[model samples]
Target: MVRIREDDINEIRNKAGIVDIISRYLPVYRKGKSYTALCPFHDDHTPSLSISEDKQIYKCFVCGAGGNVFSFVQNYEKITFPEAVVKVASLIDYPLDYEADDVREKIDPHKETLYRILEDTIKYSMYELNNTEAKKQYLEGRGLDERVRQRFEIGYNPPNDALYRFLKAKGYTD
Candidate 1:
């Protein structure tokens, strides 16, 4: 994923209304020029969290927890700062793009072959669970029914260790 730019973060913050964003997490009541709600960060009998409509900032008088909408989400939701920024950015429909690189290297062809072998192992294991006599008892013993095995794509490796020889025959070197 692309990192959000500072300008884009600021623009998203400005576009997203503090009241709308805060209301999603907690209930807010309009009190004259600002909105009030119970402080989420600390225990309190009375509503001490105040949101400034003009400044686009919120403050809790009881806990002294205060910041912009992004900070509030980060604190209340226990999410990362960047996550908060991305959440707010998505709310306001901010455009972000990742830098792409196209480069190829010729090395370790066996790595790709190993990956293919592992994939084939998984596929064969699943087939064994359904069709083979030895695998049927093993699957039942493990409580791995058809549904469970299908869900996880569980399979077994060949007993003869044929995978290595198969890859070698297919022009793969370790």
Candidate 2:
């Protein structure tokens, strides 16, 4: 599901006038800050689709197809809500920031190369820390238990370029 901020919606609504937008799709005649046009959603000869510049909405007296500009685009273009939103935003040149849902799987079994690389790095660090008694004692002295060290991803490093070598072996650069 895609979600747009209310501020973006309001901005789109304010910038993209319903009178102007409906006029592009169909002929609209203004009468005292409001416009009326033929209801495009239904077969009607009489102009029943009432558009309001003040309310920023449209209402059909006969067919009752009423909503804001987004709904207008949605019904007119025959597109999804997100697609209509994109179209309306494009009309006003509004920027949209997209984000993924917070539902990441625990772990993917068929791990990719990048995932494997990160896992291998963690395992190597764990191995380095596991085999060293001095480093363990130092960490213990610093009030960090095994669980705490593991939680914060604390690693043990030898005197040389172990991490550099690890990355190099994994086909990584810089």
Query: RMSD in Å for candidate 1, one decimal?
Result: 7.4
Writing each residue's lDDT as its tens digit, candidate 1 over 28-131 gives 99999999999999996789999999999999987899999999999988987777887776766777442212323565877777787777667656765566
lDDT of 1: 0.80
Using all chains and alpha carbons, the TM-scores for the candidates as numbered come to 0.54, 0.53
Q: lDDT values of the candidates?
A: 0.80, 0.83
lDDT at 30 for candidate 2?
A: 82
In angstroms, how far off is 16's CA in candidate 1?
0.8
Model 2 misses residue 157 by how many Å? Answer: 53
Put down candidate 2 lDDT per residue, 53-168, tens digits, no spaces: 98989999998899999899999999878778878888767787644255445566546656877777887887899889899898899999899988877777677999779888
For candidate 2, the C-alpha RMSD (Å) to the true structure equals 15.1
Q: Which whole-number lDDT from 0 to 100 does residue 36 have in model 2? A: 91
